[model samples]
Target: MRTLAPVALAAFACVAPCAANPALDALVAAYPDHLAGYESNDLIFRDGTRLPIDDGVKGKSFEQLLDAPDIKDQFAIPYPLGTANLRQPAFNEDPGRIRNQAMFVKMYGDCRKGEVKAQMKAVPWLPSRGGGTVMVTTANGVADQLAKVSRDLEQLPKEMTQYMVPSSGTFNCRVIAGTKRLSVHAYGAAIDLNAKFGDYWQWSKPKGGTLAWKNRIPLEIVEVFERHGFIWGGKWYHYDSFHFEYRPELIALARQGWPK
Candidate 1:
């Protein structure tokens, strides 16, 4: 055997950073039924369809991503999780908010075609707190995960219960306000908690096209939802505090040691 030589590590030598992040990786992994894996430059679907990782447009305006996003544009912003006071988010810190219409419609089905309702299952919301039932997708174990979230949230202090009970609604087959894009609520994978106490960006008037960020949803409630793989809308620059949708990508990166 030849004598082994000591090896010196270079400062620049490090594990190759994934072209796609762990957050994006978890998103793909979480939905194996819909996604296959990433090819060198695209997301491969189980059906052999490939979606490009980037739309090839640089410095897209916020309106561009909201109105029409390429599949990879969904990962443009990092979602901040847990309770941090509202600061004006960076120009486009709308994480989990840039949804690709084709990808969502393919996975969740088009509500207009009567395809979405078929996959929905009713989950009782804060049953112990006397909250009524809400509907969500049964796909990818979302309903089961939400049920777990409900169980844990019910055990929180009474003060926080006000924000969680009397949910505004779920499973609405409608476009997002002022836009043709389907709301995540249309997929039955999103939930809106109490509306009375929640803050919405649209409801407030901005002095000069920039609305002040505000939040009323308790951090405990947000933590419970994030723990169960749901991402809060309050984290968005266009914040909607009561909204929580099934977005494992945002939660996976923000929370440590999330299950794969």
Candidate 2:
């Protein structure tokens, strides 16, 4: 998820309240190692920091939501799991965007300051496919979950191996393109599968028009990642088919039951 410019934050004068919901519950359950619980309007961290879930603003435009979002904004788009059949998301309906900066910085230290690297551990990808090891954050058992993902992918048919080999790269401490927000990769909690099979919105979008949803990655591969708590970027409206990031909260909620 990327951050919007500061100018975007200045537009909203108040934010709406954040009531307890399935999304919040999934968030609390997903990161038991860090989150304690959530209140009517604030999320209480294990360290007892009271973070405001909503910024008290309402009626934000799609661009505004992308530029400046509170915790609740992250759930504005309900992430659809187990399938890739859907229309293009309403503008800016990026389910995984709108990450709370404070919460993430607290859970996974700031990589720009070298805090994230200290906790990173390497996990071997598809060895048979010539995939070398990639480093992921050890915090919140992310490394362990990714290892499971690798093992599952190894069992796939040989033809699918093409998309499993030669990973793009991981654990780069860089901002997302054209945004001030830190990429999930910076936290060592994300991975990019084969770039050859990848399809990105920027690359697929028609001139002067909307983003066309296109994907070549198989559902079998997507399901494997979701089983281990990773969310595929292909699921996003602004799709990036090769990208997958650790976000078990969304998966757990979808599996157990999503609140209507």
Candidate 3:
């Protein structure tokens, strides 16, 4: 929610050719409904709003990156795709965590204003196991894509139901545990599985600035979600093993091996 100074805006505008940015290309490709394309250093939305790609802040602290980021910052850390290749990310290597709040609010609508629930669609989560319906947004066909994920998840062995059945939540109008920043759940595009089997960074405090990463969510389940464009929170340095959110742009960037 930080405003750009006029001088900063003029200086950073269009420093590189628009075509040279694969990140921007991936973003437009991921969500065609909200974004039209990129021009110079601005992201052109379908509504004709040209948002600045950079906020003119250099060497941002991790907190700054999460709370105040421009459109381009969303792609600053390339997401690692698939379980076979993902590593225990180095400190603060949270790829899809750095979201461009302005861009997201533009697409998903602000939940605080009652804008997000209006777009909700009830999706049957693992109907085969009698898992009840969950509400999610229809934006960018998220509900449809989740249906596809459900089809794949339900096919897994019945024992897996213990980990998946009774989804923790989907749409919640709230901020992240300690930050002013809104959670993806606020947009109704994120899902949390059975919390009983999930591990969150905040749930267990890190010691001496080092986080001992842990996970109970099976890699098989992670792969299923990744295949359909949802990024796993377990991949983060501050991991959340039971969280999955629809972030196709991050998934698209990972597929291209993320331009260095």
Predicted structure with the largest TM-score when compared to the true one: 3
Candidates, ranked, TM-score: 3, 2, 1
CA lDDT of each candidate?
Answer: 0.78, 0.80, 0.86
Worst 10 residues of 1 by lDDT: 6-15
Q: In model 2, what is the error at residue 194, expressed in angstroms?
A: 1.1
Query: TM-score for all predictions?
Result: 0.86, 0.88, 0.92
lDDT (C-alpha) at residue 185 in model 2: 92
Instruction: Compose the digit string of candidate 1's lDDT tens values, residues 33-79.
Output: 77755645666566667777677888888899888788767766767
Q: Compare candidates 1 and 3 on lDDT and give the better one.
A: 3
Among these predictions, the greatest lDDT belongs to 3
Candidate 1 segments exceeding 4 Å error? 1-24, 84-88, 256-260
Per residue, candidate 2 scores C-alpha lDDT tens digits across 184-257 of 89899999988999998878746557677878888899999999999888877788889999988888877875
RMSD of each: 7.9, 8.2, 6.1
Error of 2 at 87 (Å): 5.2
